[model samples]
Structure formats: C-alpha cells, structure tokens
Target: MSDFLVVGGGVIGMMTTLQLADAGHSVTLLERGRCGREASWAGGGIVSPLYPWRHSAPVSRLATWSEGFYPELALRLFEETGVDPEYRQKGLLYLRVDDEAQAERWAREVGKPLERVSADFLYAKEPQAAPGFDDALWMPTLGSIRNPRLGQALRCRLEAMPRVTLREGSEVTGFRQSAARVTGVETADGIVEGDHTIVCGGAWAAELLERVWMALPVRPVKGQMILFEAPPGLVNRVVLMDGRYVIPRADGRVLAGSTLEETGFDKTTDAEAKASLRASAIGIVPALAECEVEHHWAGLRPGSPDGVPFIGAVPGLEGLHVNAGHYRNGLVLAPASTHLLVDALLGREPILDPVPYRLEGRVTSRR
Candidate 1:
C-alpha cells in the first residue's frame, strides 16, 4: 500500500484522504488547526455554482459530477458516524432583480430550464420574499449542504478507520525535496516521511510552498457572511439576488452571505460587511428583518487567477500534489476532485482532463 500524507484537513483534504484510504493506501492527515475549521466549515454550503452557465466547461463538468456524489456521501457519513450532514434538495431560486435581458440570454446559452415568473408567483411560492422583487430563474436541481456538519461527520468517520491517522495542530513547515521529488515534509516537530504528500492547505497553500522558495499564485479572498435565526418554514428555498444569496437550513437559521474581499489571511469580520449583507438579505426577504442575527464570521477562500481550482501533481515534484485554489466552490467540487486525485495517483485514467488544473502557471520555479 502507498503511504500518503495529506496536508490541510479541510473538506478537500479530508475527502481526498478518505478516498485514498478506502483504496487501501495508508493515509496520514496533518492539520495546522482543528480539522475542517477553515474555509470548509465557514462557507455558505451552497452545493452548486452561483451561475452554472458562467463557469467554464471544466468547472461545470466537475461540479455536476461532484454534486451527484454528495447524496451518497452524506448518507454514508450519517450511517457510519451518526452525524447528519443535512444534504437537501430544496432547489434554488435566482431572482432577476435587474438585467432581465442578460438573464434571458444566459438562460438560453446555459440550456438550463429557467422559468420566468411574475411578482405574484414569486410571493405565492415564498410569501416571506420582499414585495418589490419580481422575476427569477428557478433551477430545481441546485441544492446545498450543511458544511460544518459535513466536516464533523467526515472527521468522525476518519477516526473509525484504523488505516487513517489524523494529526491535528501539527503545522508542516516545509518539504524535503530531492532533484525531482519531495520525499517528506518538515514539520514543527520534525521530518515526517511519506511516499506522497498532497498539499490541500486552501488559502494557506502559498505560504507553505514559500518555505521551499516556491510560490503559488493563489491568494486568500476573504468572504464575510451572517446568519439569522428565523422560525422554521420562514424560508423554504435558497434564493440568490444579484451577487448576494440567502440559504435557509432545516433548522430555523437562515445564512446570508457574503462579501468577497481581496484581503490576505485576515478572517476578521467587518461590521460594515455584516451590515451590508443584512441590508441585502432584508431587501430580498423582508421577513428576515424581524429575525435575530445569530452568527457572523469570515473565511479565506483560496482564489486562483482563473476561477477553476488547481488539482493534480506539482511539476518537478514527483511525490507532491496540490488540490487547492477552489475559491468558493471547494465543497461543491470536493467529490470529483477527490476522485481525480486518487485516479491520477493510482495511474488510472481520470474522469476529467488534468491539464487545466496543473500547477504550471501557479507555482514558481522549484528548488
């Protein structure tokens, strides 16, 4: 069995480790902090892209494939770990507050079924929605999952696997590299040897590679989101207005997010950002104005130059791989990415082309 070291214990890292371990590979996961507490836990948990048509073909393919795997994964995790990930198919309503013609054009190009409804129909479907909002594109297949619950479930499941070893609060400082391969990682404690090392560090990926005089073009795009507690059934569907979105959970909480900021590694929630999100949410759903704000937080998404995530092996580093720079679609793309990583590592044919996700453009010259 191949010995594998997975750096970063976010959803992508954890999912990859699980896939590899299930394939009979000895897997060890190292997390700098609590597993899955970073972007994976802090996300809005929307299981689909904001605009599926706007994304590139590769991203759309990966998302579609990954979304198909979530239901099975959720069920398995709940059965094995007894923690529900709350995977729901509550459909998404993307309101076209402005730019009706643009929305129509996109709908035609996307080939996805989008029904144009009047203001009355929208209110009849969701009475809590604001009065002024009218037309929208309804996508019945779009859905969401509870991110924190998924993380917890994955951790619990991993703990039950004897082949999987989780090292929490262990920071990997650098790597031990030869002429063409990374043999092991240099951590705060000491060198940890492994056959393969996959860096899934999310926003912190670039910093980890910098210790070896290598740099990834990835940057942390800070997103601030707010949560409000409403009565159950207040909002039944996920709604998106312009660039903002409001996701309702099975519980009484409605998560309204998020402002994408280019700030580096600063996860501090801005009061103004929260206020802006609250205003936007209220504008879409007036009933939310009466809801109590429950929580507000920020996360650093690993933003790439292009919108697509970086996957597959890092060039010139034979045993090193990267599965980060997923931006806001990390959770949505986790399943397919895990599959691709495993297939590539095992010398099997990948479902998608691995060229676009290669680290050529992102990584600087390797030592």
Candidate 2:
C-alpha cells in the first residue's frame, strides 16, 4: 500500500485521510491543534453554494456530487462513530426583500425549480419571520449539516481505521524535498517521511507552501457567527437573507451568522459586526430577538482569487498535492474534493475537469 501524509485536520483534511485509508493506503494525518476545531467547525454548514449559478461550472458540479454523497456518508459515519452529524434537508428560503430583479435573474440562471411566495405565504410557512419581509424564492433541495458534530464523527470514524495514524497537536514546520519530489515533512518533533504529501492546511496553507518557495493564493476571510438556544420548531427551514443565514437545529439551537471580512488570520469577533448580524437576523425573523445568545465566535475561511479551490499536484513538487482554498464551501465540497484528489493521484479519470482548479503553471504567480 502507498503511504500518504496529510497536513491539516479540518474537514477537508479529515475527509481526504478517510478516503485515502479506505482505499487501502497507509495514511498519517498531522494536526497543529485539535482536529476540526478551525474553519470546518466554524462554518455555517450550508451544503449548497450561496449562488450556485454564479460559481464556476466545476465548483457547481463538485458541490452537486458531494451533496449526493452526504446522505449515505452521514448515515455511515453516525452508525460507525455513534455521533449524529444531523444532516437535514430542511430546504432554504431566499427572501427577496429588496432586489427583485436580481432575485428573478438568479432564479432564471440557476434553472432550479423556484416558487415566488408573497408575504402572507411566508408568514404561513414561518410564523416567526419578521413582518416587513415580503417576497421570497423557495429552493427545496438545499440542506445543512451540524458542522461540529460532523467533525467529531469524522475524527471518531477515522481513528477506528487500522491503516491510519492521527497525530494531534503536531505542527509541520517544513518539508524535505529531493529535486521536484517531496521526500517527507519536518515537524516539531522530527522528520516523518512519506511517499506522498497533500497539503490541506486550510487558512494556513500558504505558510506551509512558503517552505518550498511556492505559495497558493489563499487568504483568510473572517466570519463571526452566534448561536441561540430556542425551543424546537422555532424555525423549520434554513433561511437566507441577503448574505446572512439562520439555521435551526433539531434540538433547540438556532445558528445565525455571519460577516465576511478580509482580515488576515484574525479570529476575533467585532462588536459592530455582531450587532449588525443580530439586527439583520432579527429583521429576518423577529423571534431571534427574544432568544438568548448562547455562543459567539469567529473563524477564518480560506479564500482564493477566483473563488474556486486549488486542487491538483503542486508544481515543482511531483509527489505533493493541494486541496485548499475552498472558502465557505469546504464541508459541502469535501467529499468530491477528496474523491477527485484520490483519482488524480491514481491516474484515473476525474469526475470534473481539473483545468479550472489546476495548480501547475500558476504556483509561482499565486500569492
């Protein structure tokens, strides 16, 4: 069996490790901190893109393929690890409170079945929604997942694999390269050699690539989210308003997020951002104003120049690969990303063209 080393412990890293191990490859996963505690845990867990038609064709295809796998993957992970990821098809309601023309354009461009609903229909559907909000486009295929629980489930299930070695709190300082191929990684403890290495470092990918005088154009975009404890059935479906979203769990927790800021590696939450999110969320659903805020935190998303993830072999490094820069859709695209990476490593046909996300000629130019 081939030996593989994955640097990073977020959802993308964990999922890639799981896929590699299941394919009978000996896998070693190194995490600088606790696994899945970074962007993966901090995400809003929306499975579909904010605007699917606006994204590249490859990105949309990967998301569609990954969404199809969540049903079976969630069930299997829950059964094996005894932790429910809470994958739900509660649908999403994109309210068109202001931009009617933009909403209509999106509906036509996406070609998805969408129904225009009036204010009365919205009130009937979600009694807690605010009064002023009127028209909305309903897309029933969108879904969400409990991100923290998903990470926990993945960690548990991956730990059970005989061929996988998980190293938590292990920081990779650099790599050992011979000509164009990476021989191994140099960690805080010592050098651990592997046949191949995949950098799934999330927001910290560029730091690792810098060791090889190469960089990926991945930047950290900060987002702040708040959690509220409410009664069950408070809100039945995921609701989207402009750029914000309110997601309700099966229990009694409602998650409201988030503000996208171009802050570099800063995970601090801003008071103004929080206040704005609270105001905007309450505007969408007035009941959120009464709910107690249980938790408030922030995380950085790995963003790229073209809003698409870089997934391919790193140039000048034959045995090294990258699957980072997924921005906000890491969890939704994890399965398909892992599948594509595995196939590329094995010289198999990829589900989608690797051209748009390729890393060959642009490695030196990437920031």
lDDT of 1: 0.86
| Model 2 CA lDDT for position 196 | 93
For residue 353, give model 1's deviation from the true position in Å: 1.7
User: What is residue 46's positional error in candidate 1, in angstroms?
Assistant: 0.4
**Which stretch of 10 consecutive residues in model 1 shows the poorest summed lDDT?**
97-106
TM-score of each: 0.95, 0.95
Residue pairs whose backbone atoms clash in candidate 1: none
Clashing pairs in 2: none
TM-score of 1: 0.95
Residue-level lDDT of model 2, residues 102-147, one tens digit each, is 6467666756556677778787778887777656777777888999
